[model samples]
Target: MSPLNSALFKNTTNDNIVHPDYFVISGFAGIPQTKYYYVFLCFVYALTIIGNTFVMFMIYIDHCLHSPKYIVVFNLALSDLCGSTALVPLVIDTFLFKSHLMSFHACLTSMFFVLGFITVQSFSLAALSYDRCVAICFPLRFNDIVTNKSMSFIIAILWIIAALAFLVAVIYINKLSFCRSNVINSYFCDHGPLHLLACNDNTPSTVMNWACQVVIFWLPVIFIVSSYICITRALLKIAAASERLKAMKTCTSHLILVAVFYLPLCVSFALGGALHMNARIINMSLASVMPQMLNPFIYSLKTDEFRESIKKLYRRKKMHITGRNT
Candidate 1:
């Protein structure tokens, strides 16, 4: 064992399991002038919270919006809200407040919630794509195919799957002996960074890392792409040019959302080895948070129903204020 591993193993319990008291988060290390970056993260978090909340509130109050499609939208908004909550504030506390020391259990808990919500967010986008696919491809049978109850069931299953998967990953981390460095090199207590700190066999965790990539990233992306292809084929079948445009219009928001969320990630993954550590971290961080901040705005502006709902709500609030003044 190296000197660092020897020092870590000195804290071993009677059961021969090494558990460090706390981990030093080194994500922002070697970066200069990060205060401005922290401020920007704060701004992004605030926008994500406000925008997602507004979308959810609009869907809740409008009976017309309480359909299968809106159910998927509402699920996306909720996941964005919760995912940002899980990640940003803790990030602010860790970096901005300079509280980089996280306890072992605390680190695991953070890992679970952050990764769990991210998993849900990824699958939620896939669910939204499925909604669009059904709506566009089978317009006549859209209601029969996708209902409120069914959408709710799908969302529930996604949550359960994400929770269980991350929970198992965390359990695996708990079992590992951290006899190496206690410093995690990611912006958060990420699975790869945490598992790499283990001095014992980490093959399981390594396998889980690839498994998570398949579940959280690749699978959802593939599903969304396939759904859009089906939607395109359906649109091409429409004889009238006007009808084709109308059908294609509805998918614009979803397409933009997919691009916004996935493109940055794709770029980062493609250039991973070429970029410096700080640059890679910055790119990944932006990719994660920017999508949540942008989703609500995209849906609000692009979806006719959501935009109308917002207008109705605004008029109602304006009239109420005028009445009070009178």
Candidate 2:
């Protein structure tokens, strides 16, 4: 059976020929058992949504987390929630329900937002690195430097940059004639998959994608790496053993999370423009889902307050149900 003849190709209304061998490399492909695969995917989706939602609620409802320490975490949660929602559900629908009815317009919308939110999440990490730097490096000025107003302004700026990146890609594609096969290799429409279908010269699209990738991924990563090094060095400079230990504890966990989240992205980026179609699809799936899966566990679990909040939230819900039953 030709990959193109699969359900996704049947919906292709254009003259472009869908590649017969082009299978979407997604989470579904990673797991062999379709039943267990979807069950696990659903589990990840539920955990991501619930965990991030809890983080958001803790930041918003709990006054203790109103400080700048958790403000970046809250914003990071917001980005992860939106990013995962944009990518995960569509993949589930395509693989689990066998609904590959994403039209060109719908594909474009989904791709735009997924890229936007993921970019926001990346930059939010950069912002978070800066936040941690301030908290550790300049304890005296932490409050004054990382005010609610300042954090809000930084978040707004990150969103604006992300919006612009999405707009540019959308506008660029809007001008191109998508006369080739419209069957996107991946479950969702991304610039890369859609651009693969373009009949016209894609030099500009390729260049723009590279440029944006550099700015969005690499630039922030540079800042994150450099700032973290400085932060570690500064922490080491502290004289007191207990305070130094506490600082190392914070920095180590955060650094590990940052490395886990960004390293795959660097690998993907290094693969560059000549990557095989299937390889690209696999990388995209991993990059999109892994960070969201790891985030709550990595960032929030060690925090006493977040754990307490989780316990309290579930305990209250259980109590309410028990009371009603009794």
Candidate 3:
């Protein structure tokens, strides 16, 4: 059989009348061997959720963390949680049972959340870069403009934009007929695989998909990087060496987070799709999980105010527990 035919028609019924109720995920690394990696995949998924949740919780419980930067940070954590939740569980099911079968609704649901949160993450990072730019470039005017409430409002606006774009794309995708093959070449229901599965003239969905990808993905990356460039230029004018160092320190964590999030995505896009990821599941998992897992660490390590807040929260909790026992 030809390669395209082989990939498309695998595990499909011979009947022309069959409308698929369940779809299969031929994960990048498929079947038996995939099971061996289940434990590690689960561990990565766990770290993604636990680490992000801990940071989000820390931000929520501590009033000191209620600043503009941390508000954006909280939204980033929320995006990570949504994205990981959508993909990892389905992947675990595919690996553990050697069964890649997913219901039609389940597949679409996964596609929606995974892509939605990706949009969320991209715009959130863009907002973070903008915040950093304002602080460094117009330090005096930053207080008047970008307050905590304003940051939260900006995040809300971005979230609404992402959701609307993703929602329209998902609805467009769902309207496409899928009489061809149910075996998608992915670990879960990703856009490319679904596009391949559609038997109709997919021009509309394809156009919308690419449009959303460019707008929600590449657009935000460009904006963030541009903001940072302007930030660096503004910092160069600072007369005091000590002040320059302090300004650079404020940006370190956000810059690192941006790189971590975008690098893997760039790799996957350059390679065609995540299913075609070079190292298969391992590389793909790392790309998806690492940024979320490492974000809290970057913030804690670089920002002394955030670090102290975490420490103080811990001390307070410890005292509370001690008093309760006594």
Candidate 4:
């Protein structure tokens, strides 16, 4: 062992706060053919990167997609890209390559980015819901209420709040003294698993766990559901059935995105201990990654604006290529 590792393991201080130099990430241990799972994650990560980048590129090149709703969609795609990058690559490294050892600060860094981007992803969905709600419920005032500037401000606030919240949780994890086993059971440096390894009192970490659940999961879900309720009422108030259908049609992409993101998570949380440990891990991992991979496709295929923007971009590219060849 190196000198730093020696010092860390010795716990020579009078306070008895033992800080280990590294942690062993025992991800999917004892599971059969875990390599196959890692390969699947590699595919998911690749698709997530390409799909989200394409969505963002479409939004950027086409000025018609510069609306408030597209702003929210862009934010969601950005978060999906980031969240998948934070998680999938590291997971592949740890499990596929058998690089299970993670340094103290590295673990904290991973936890912060993973959780922060995920929280942003959740809030971005809610932001999209709000955009849809405003468009359907207040059609005349949608321009004034949900401008690009206002949408940008909301996204900025969500990113700031998520960063600060996860930063605090990571700071709390840093304060913990890991005197016992440093083996994390999850695929990544998860907050709860890391904090549970601490030898000292973990009340704050425990509290933060529940707080994260409420803030990251429950609150956004409630907001999205409530927004949909408002949207439904607004649609009902429309006199013509065709108008109601048209208004509701605008929400299909966002609703699908919401369902793709939240339903697996809801099932995972609901099943809790009823699931086998490995099964739960698989469910949670899928929940984390599948939405990121699917969000761009859902929006691009379902949203008419995105399809139009894509077609515009394609025609522009074709014209440019023909001009260059001539």
Candidate 5:
């Protein structure tokens, strides 16, 4: 069988479709080795949905959470909601319906939105790290520096940059003509999967994609790491044990989020060009899913305030339900 035919059409033996030419060079990897893997994905999806939704609600209903810091958190939670929801449902559809085929437009739209939100989320986290550094290291100036006006500006800038980054990608994609092999290997349409369909001459899009990765992913990650390092060092120098502990808690949570998010994202986007088509798909899925699956839990579990907020929200809900019944 021809490679194009083999990739686009389902193989009876593999029971999965192959990567289309518009995407990357390889096919997907890492189907759940056991039933447990499927269960785990479902669990991640469930928690991601619930956790992000609840976080949104907390920020929405609580007037107190309207501060600059919480605004950043709200955006992060929103991104996580969209990012995970965009991919997981499609993945579930694949598993449940055996319907792995995504329409061409659906594939394109999904790829664009997923990449866009992930980029925006990275920027938001970077902003959050800066906000923490300022709050902790310069407590007196935190309010003045991180005002609502400035916060809105920062969020707007981040979204603009993210939109431009993805928009450039969309334009690049327009240049590539998909001659054959439109089947996407994985459950969702990522840039890698879309690139495989391009004719052999996919240089412009590939280069542009790399450029976006560097600017959109690594640049913010570097700043986030460096800012946190400075924040941690400053906290250590302080004399009060209690104060130091508080700083440590905040800094640690932000750093953990930065690492979890950037590491996999960098890995996946980094491998976008270099790896073979099949291996790239595997790497892409790994990179895309892990950060998203872990994001909601990371933020909720790591922060005491967020956890308490979630608890209170749930308790209120429970009481409301009981009252309705009574």
Candidate 6:
């Protein structure tokens, strides 16, 4: 459709208008031996999907984990599985299959999911922090405040709010005119590069973008930090050394998760927007997905209940195999 003819686009002339067939995603275009990068992406997808699935499965089958805490972790694993699945396959295709021919609507859809997952992750992490805060700060009141029914209600509201923010974001972008270039510069359809491609006056969308960022990014960081501080204070007040250590132990996995997700993202976005940092931005963008790979291991290695459940599952499997042979 012509940019001028379309109702969605603002005022535009023929000089800044060309509705190309599709956008070319030239990922790693300047680099040699592109097939090697494709191979590595394959490894990333394989590990991410498999490990996250195992985490979900273990939580499901283990009766010991039928509590609010495990349920929250289960949702995070689900988000990781879905978020990686949504972006990575198409990313591999764009790298290997000469993916310079994706439709405009397809590009928007990919961008939506990529950002949508980040939105889900933001809410998920905040929910996890809130749960931890209640448990650690109010031991006696934890049962009343953090029950399974209440947790479900809170998660529902968090998801609804996040969904609305991303929906508004996509609608805002869709209203703009894109006549700048049909070539996107990232591995996938990130919102930043796509926003840069718009030829229209993008002040509205830019403001909305920042609004969404404040809700989905900065708010979660503030809440997570505040929750951890209270948790730390609570841990310090324990009368015995062993009790304090035990209290701290329960929080270790969550703190690791917060660091794994937030730190890389903050650094990547901060430096990615800096002047003369093209190489650093691309490397950091690649690094952002590393958290999905690390999350399963972090929970499995550090969380006692999950670790014990997995061991019990393994012993059962081994005994079953031996029995069958006998």
Task: List the pairs of residues colliding in candidate 4.
Answer: none
Assess candidate 5 and give its TM-score to the true structure: 0.78
lDDT of each: 0.88, 0.75, 0.79, 0.88, 0.72, 0.78
Better of 4 and 6 by TM-score: 4
**TM per candidate:** 0.95, 0.81, 0.87, 0.95, 0.78, 0.89
> Each model's number of backbone clashes?
0, 2, 0, 0, 20, 0
Model 2 Cα displacement at 7 (Å)? 17
Q: What lDDT tens digits, residue by residue, belong to model 3 across residues 1-326? A: 35553443322343422235778877755435555577777887888888888889989988988889889989998998888887777778776776677777687778878878878888888999999999999999998989988998999998888878877877777667666677776677877667767776789889987888797678998898799899889989999999999999888888898888888778767775435343654565667667767877788787788889888988998999999999
RMSD (Cα, Å) of candidate 2?
Answer: 5.3
Q: How far is candidate 1 from the true structure (C-alpha RMSD, Å)?
A: 1.8
User: Candidate 6 lDDT, tens digit per residue, 22-45?
Assistant: 677765776678688678777878
Which wins on lDDT, candidate 3 or candidate 4?
Answer: 4
Off-target runs (Cα >4 Å) in candidate 4 are 1-14, 324-326
Model 4 RMSD vs true structure:
2.5
State the displacement of the C-alpha of residue 63, model 1, in Å, after optimal TM-score superposition: 0.7
lDDT tens digits, residue span 1-326, model 5 = 47755454332232332333233211333444424545666887787778778777878887767888788888888888888778767666665555656655566677778888888888888899889989888889999999988998999989998888788787676556564666556557767557656654788888877777776677887888788788878888899999898777776677777777667656655676676655655555556567665666777788777777778888999999999999
The number of residue pairs in model 2 that clash at the backbone is 2
- Where does model 1 exceed 4 Å of error? 1-14
TM-score of 4: 0.95
The stretch of ten residues in a row with the least summed lDDT in candidate 2 is 16-25
Question: Could you tell me the lDDT of residue 42 within candidate 5?
Answer: 80
Clashing pairs in 3: none
The parts of candidate 5 lying over 4 Å away from their true place are 1-36, 183-187, 265-287, 308-326
Worst 10 residues of 1 by lDDT: 5-14
What would the per-residue lDDT of candidate 1 be over residues 1-326, giving only the tens digit for each residue?
67764654445454756888888888887789999999999999999999999999999999999998888889889988988998999888999899998988899999999889889888988998999899988889998999999999999999999999999999888878887688888899899878998878889989998898888999999999999899889888899999999888888998898899888879877887798889888888888799999999999999999999989998999999999999
Candidate 3's error at 114, in angstroms? 1.3
